[model samples]
Target: MPKPIEEIQKEVVEEFSDLTDWEEKFQYLIELGEALPSYPEDKKVEEYLVPGCQSRVWLYPKEDSGNLQFLADSDTALTKGLIAILIRVFSDHKPQEIAEASLSFIDEIGLSKFLSISRRNGLNSMVNLLKNYAKNPNV
Candidate 1:
């Protein structure tokens, strides 16, 4: 079995702790975003686009064995990195696991401070969208 979500979150936090400055953190985040799996061109549609983001972000969630698998992308590089962390924390986890989990890593890593007000709103939108997908009964 895969490591528990908490373990994954802890690892992420530890990884971020190594980067002492926000500039290095930002660069690290971009690298993380680059590591994300490719988003399908066909699935990039209006319905999947996350609302309230300054940049265009598309998120697709599929249920597999009661866990949510996500495919996400953004028009902006920084947003891409932000969403990648969200996906890393949420993906391959059960709906209950995702919905109930706390995303304190955002604060722990000082990610929120790095974001502009609009970007933070967009991050919330992305998170809400993911939670909404988890709450779907039909998935």
Candidate 2:
């Protein structure tokens, strides 16, 4: 089974705690970005677009046996990793679970502290998109 979000947050905090500087944090973000799967070019347009992001983003959601699954792609590497992290936390959950998760969990995971203001805003936008989808999957 996949780890719980709390466990994942703890792991990420512990794993990266040694990085004491912003430069190191930025490097780590890039490294995380490297692990994200590529988004197909065709899917990067229209309805999938995430506004307020510096990079192009596309998110597709599907329901499987009462669970929600998200497939996301971003033009910017760091943004892609950010989406990957979100997917790891939200995917495979029931729509109610996804919708009910506190957006403050981003800060609990230390993502807000390490990210730029714009990046944090972008991340919020992404989370909002997912929550909206969870609330209205047929839209």
Per-model CA lDDT versus the true structure: 0.88, 0.78
Please report, as a residue range, the 10-residue window in candidate 1 with the lowest summed lDDT. 130-139
Worst window of 10 by summed lDDT in candidate 2: 1-10
Indicate the TM-score of model 1: 0.95
Cα deviation at 38, candidate 1, in Å, is 0.9
How displaced is residue 55 in candidate 1, in Å? 0.5
For model 2, residues 57-95, the per-residue Cα lDDT tens digits are 789888888888888887787888788878877888888
Colliding residue pairs in candidate 1: none
Return the top candidate by TM-score.
1
TM-score of each model, paired residue for residue: 0.95, 0.82
* Per-candidate clashes, comma-separated: 0, 0
